[model samples]
Target: MALVGPEEPHYCNHHVVASTGRTRKMTLVRALRPFRVVRRTLAVFTLGAMVIVSFALLPSNVADAATVPVSTQAVVQTAPDLAKICARLKITVARTSLCSHGPDPVDAFGGGARLKQTSAVQEQGVAAAPASELTALCNADGVSGKRIEVIYGVPQDRTNRFSAMVAPLRDMMRQVNNNLEAADAATSQNYRFLCTNGVDVTVRNVTLLPVGSDASFTFDDYVASLQNQIAFGLGPVDFIANERLYIAYIDQVQDSYPFGGQGELSIDDQPSAAANANNDSRPRYSMSAYLDMPVMAHEIGHNIGAVQDSAPHSSKGGHCYDEADLMCYDDGGLYFALGGTLTFTCPGADTAIDCHDEDYYYPGTPPASNYLATHWNTANSGFLTPVVSAATPPTVTGKSPVSQATRVAQTANATATFSEAVQGVSTTTMRIKNPGGTVLSSAVSYNTTTRVATINPSASLAADTKYSVSLTGGVTGIRDLSGSPLVSTGWSFTTGPAPTITTRTPGSGATGASRTASVSVTFSEGMAGVAASTFKLKNTATGAAITALVSRNGTTNQWILNPSATLAATTNFTVTITGGSTAVRDLAGNPVSTSIWRFTTGS
Candidate 1:
């Protein structure tokens, strides 16, 4: 698995006392070890006592996530300690912990993106939030966003003072929220709920906690608690069962000792700093806190949406000024300079501006995209700002051609609002079988006002023919709210066929003896369920028929074919799937594909 680290030239708005200007020469080490109990959640790295890591990897088709609603009974069963904590905060965990464990609930309002780790133990259960849900929430809010919930595990000696940390925590939450909202709105997908209308997302809060009276709590304990109470009420095992979720943990490993209570350290510690002349071993508590926040943010950023490769500042993954990357381990003014500059909109403004001079950092000055606006706020102002940016922005854009004949229909749409205006729609078009592979009609229509184009035959389009459409030229210009002469790239779309047989895995005239070889097929449309006994297979020679079986996989229209008995050697077999007669129907409400095929069986 490719490891993700921050880009270089670390930037933040936090303060620190010194710059060691040291680099730890690291030897290539094995990547995180896979977790056993939670097969998917691996131990990524050890930072102090905290284990900083993310889920191993998610399945390819990771888009489908579970959506079970919260159950009141489940919430009622939560441990009293958690309930008391919730009560003290005046918040209601409408859903049980199990529900809270998944990305959907934890990040419902973009809360997960703004969190940070306050204590090592808290990092134990740090799991990756679902990227789709996070992205969905970010899009809903019309901004790019992030969350980092810190669990502070203090000894009994420091327990009572938990209230003292509240103000700073609240501030951090606010800053993180603000940045998230801003990023969401300022970027694409402008609002939180494109599913809903445009609206600012209400900022979510960050929760800090003191451990319950458990004798000894291991990382798995937190995982279990979160799982039983939050994930699926089935605990961490569900992580693999439901691969959509990933986990991560970050902690401080070294002491403020021999180094003279100093917080500054290199990403790699080649050697403990040479004894300082003054031997001024004064502890810097806050600096330690500040440094860890950005590191945590950069790591979690790796697991977001689709995991992508990191482009470090020095290219070798060391500190550099251009990227404003927190992963490079650069400790300088840049970490806490974002808030100092009051100019919120100065062009070319960066998280690194004045924090760390370009000369002090290296390689081409990296871009500022990697900067965490909220973390920058935390370092500068001792708090977080809500509003990562707007979540959802809207526009009308759609598929071109409206039809295709040469290949499977492929069309795309462009959101006019996202663009400055709409150009002429494409006239060249052709229609084909809904599943494509067959050409039928080409006539298409474009709505310049709505920015949507329809492709159909000059007459009524076929009910089941999927049409591919595009927009090339010919329509009058439609300007956007920005008045920037609407310009956009091309788009595509597919027409629909009511229901038709698309393709079958084992075509007619096949001969295979493997009993495990099952027959399967794709349809032009979705199908509904019917009485299980409706489908069947038959032997052509004896005229004896058997009622084969069909079952749905996940919610897809695809079905499985179960043969009742082994095929006779050297025998002719025929399979038939009845659709309209059964309960099956395409998504368009068209009849199911009454498909049939015949093949010879070998011994």
Candidate 2:
């Protein structure tokens, strides 16, 4: 079903698109660089009020925070101030988007209602296994055999504040996963990070870096240090052959840093893949900036695969220019960097991965030989929920009195089931109106657990009237929690009298009825579903129904009941058309009130 979402994100379809440009990028092999746009958001929330709030809220991802016996460490000093973080990064630029917005609370969607920004959405699903309860394999939860290991990487010179961060880190990661889950929900997929027993992110039992963070570290330094440390520490078993993405959450003062985190981009623009240390075509490691959910999601987004140079909207440093998208920003190449205007109209959720599917992420079975198909697809990433064809925004999956249904009960509640859980439903979003278009007073409520939204009229509907039910979607309209707006859809149904048998063959209680002939009953209106349960023949004395072959004559609006055998002479039989919702219904779905008639057969 078509879902109403933000104006389809604008993209020049024919611009730079190639069936295969593998030749150009084949020789330009490079790992992730430091200044990608996603890393530009300088949200230093962990050092401010968010740490105070998020730390206190029990992470829904973790079943329990106290269960994992963690290593003890020094009490963490108050998180670094925004000034300290920006200073550490040597950011002389004035604060606006990322750098200074750390302490100033803002909506996660950034500038629009189209998509949900990357933040923790409370998921009412089963709790992921705690760290201590993790299974023998890394595939215990999401994406088989691969995992994103979370670590509280401490700086040796800064301080070992491991103990204080366990809960906060788990909570922080929970926000990231929730956003991912929301994205998955939007795409009609189920992608999520591996949540092992420890911190809902693997850190405890798995080998983590023992060396602490050093002062004045660079992106290159961090990458090389961790790679070397893990290579030496893992000792050939999990290290040399390991194909996991390691996420390090360090409590370092982030001043003077140009990036919040850096990760190796495993997506190759070339069609023929080259062999690597992990063998799998996915990023192996990402570091820092995870204390913030959006940045964490952005960094990890690079790890899985996204915003590649091959994308239509891609910029020089691996970002999109479609404003309001989590990955879109003016990072120096695309429209935003070329001095073009941005509408801030990114579709779906603020944290939505690819503003337009054609660019970095394709929710569909990518057409053969295209950039999306040849390059790694985030929708098909081993770490995400398996893809199912193309993904559409959440929509009304089912509805009551489906379009064009007749004979709807005036008191019946008009219910709608969404493909996934949605929010912002009201009379303004959904409504029932008469044929003349006067809206009925209605109440709408949504059930998060069932993903159903219900709407009921304040009073019973009018009899014999045609009414329509409409649901609206778009930015500021009905939207799924994951960020897709329901596309507007409505069906009309007529309300009227239930069909009744207008006349019966051989008038009721007639002295003689033809034993060799069939019995017929005509209804007041055209009939649709007529079954044995609704149309039955029974011996008046024995009360046993006669087996009969029933057929309808559309021209006459009549149902003919022919018994399997000749009727007994001089016997009285009763014919009944049972009513009620499940009984015999008319084309308009109105059921006939129960009616019974008796006739005597000829001797």
Clash counts for the predictions, in order: 138, 27
**TM-score, one value per model:** 0.24, 0.41
Off by over 4 Å in 1: 1-26, 29-394, 397-478, 481-603
Local accuracy of candidate 2 as per-residue lDDT tens digits, 31-63: 322222222232332233233222011111112
Tens-place lDDT digits, model 1, residues 106-153: 111111221222232223332222122223233323422222223322
Q: Pairing residues by index, what is the TM-score of model 2?
A: 0.41
Top candidate (lDDT): 2
Which 10-residue span in candidate 2 carries the lowest summed lDDT? 14-23
lDDT of 1: 0.28
